[model samples]
Target: MKNITFADAQNLKNPIFIDIRSPREYAEDHIEGAINLPLFSDQEREIIGKIYKYEGVSQAKLAGLNFLSPKLPRLVKEILAYKEKGDIVVYCWRGGLRSLVFTEILRLVDIYVYRLEGGYKSYRQEVVRFFETAKTLFPVVLYGMTGVGKTLILKKLAEKGLPVLNLEQLASHRGSVFGHLGLLPQPSQKRFESMLYDVLKELKGFPFLVEGESRKIGKLFLPKELFQRMQEAPVILLELPEEQRIKNLLRDYQVDKIDIKYFLESLQSITVYLGRAKVESLSEDLKKGRFYEFTKTLLREYYDPLYKKSTAYLRNIKKVISGNDIDELVAGISEYWGEFTGRDLK
Candidate 1:
């Protein structure tokens, strides 16, 4: 069993990280791309903790061993299966007893594996440090009114092998009042930062593209340094006709397929802004399948006005790309970015 620093383990080709923490711990936050194979279940961990606190370390160790004895054979077999695919590196909360003992057991079976030196805690510290000191990033921010295809453009750019920091995807929210309507629950703040760090690391030293967003996205907040960098970076404004914008939004939101009751519930959030009477009218339109009218009313009365106010503070507008065709709009953005950065996209 060899002990490896997080940096060294990360450099290992085709490394499979096995997290030896409890399932609940892993669920809260763990290294990205890690597989969880716990040494104890959540309840067992609690039992061990109580023993350690009341009965002392010696008794706690005895209890832990008893619990682990029955699971040893199954655990070794599961790890071996992963070893066949790639190098297996194991870690616990702080590269402590659990990982140390597990690797020692594997050694007895002639299964050599690497142990993460400082565990998930170490990796998390690295993530926090990154956002604290990341200052040289060049972000080409995409700014546009709602339904102007900013997210779609980012997806297309990524498909073409360009660097893109997709904050919305990381947060699992679309960055709006209704952003969470059809999306999965947002990641925890720590997990969001960790995932963001992974992407930024991959795109280091490149001019990555990102969308213009407020400090907060759904329940998560962007790191202050990252938001500052985006604010100071060059901006590209996208435009689409009002009718086309409404159509794009309707498709994006899947208004026709979403539960009307839930949609009406989401509408309640904006009652103060749209007024109670207007929200009621929108609800009626939605019930009657008047999605076009519903979307148009929201965009013109709510989204567009808010967007106008948001952009008022942005002083840097390097280019504007507008078109009815998505492909053409992408081409226009790519062409301008290539000229501005003097880097060929093709």
Candidate 2:
């Protein structure tokens, strides 16, 4: 079997990445685009582990073989479908027996396959090191209160091929107490690191734009290497009138579109800070279809005050753009950054 490092696998043109970990492990995280071709279900893996620990390695091996023998034909059939897609890179948790078996079996049938050396663990290490040592990055941090459309602005910039990092997108969270309001559950910390590493590696020396966020986003923390750079980069304050911000926020949040029970529970979490009387009043506003009033109160009392405390320390205040909506934001960014479209950002 051809043995390759994660670096080699990454550079391989149009490679099919097959993850052969257990379903449970894959559910936690896998290579961003890799296909899950589990070698064992979670229960099977647990049983094998117990047998290996309590019985012996030899007995455990036999049990593993019994489990695999029937699945082999189906596995081969499944893998063969991807034969012409690209070169195959197979990995498990640690390039252990499961992946090795897959590599050998595929090779025996004359399909070119490479086993990832040290597997996902090794790939993860590469990710950690990339951010830890990244010094070539030029960041343009967007500073503004919530609902100022930092994330939306980044999306537009990315569409324009300007380097931009969506930390909120990577974490699959909005970096708030209610960030997960209508979104999927945030990835596990390990999974978040994997996704973060993948995106950062692709950026390579671009003066990317990003939102101003704390060290943590929901359950995930920013890699200190990257966060430190953001802390020092040029800051552009995105200021808009409060009335416009509130209007943008109501549509942006889609608070009424969320699961009512879930939304209420989320608000309940911060009631201690809001006080019981205030919380009850807001709930009544929501139940009575006073979303605008409820949202306006939420912003005035909670989001705005919380955001103002942090803006006092913004570094390298290079410029400020006051605008609302995508077109206006795009024009503001272009006006500020027009001269260096293809060159390195200052």
How many pairs of residues collide in each model? 0, 0
Taken over the whole model, the C-alpha lDDT of each candidate is: 0.89, 0.82
Q: How accurate is candidate 1 locally (lDDT)?
A: 0.89
Best by TM-score: 1
Off by over 4 Å in 2: 340-346
Candidate 2, TM-score vs. the true structure?
0.93
Instruction: Judging by lDDT against the true structure, name the best candidate.
Output: 1
Tell me the tens digit of each residue's lDDT in model 2 across 183-286.
Answer: 78888887888887677668777677888989999888988888898988888888877777777777767877976666677889888788999999988888
lDDT of 2: 0.82
Give lDDT: candidate 2, residue 265: 77
Please give the lDDT score at residue 311 for candidate 1.
Answer: 61
- What is candidate 1's TM-score against the reference? 0.94
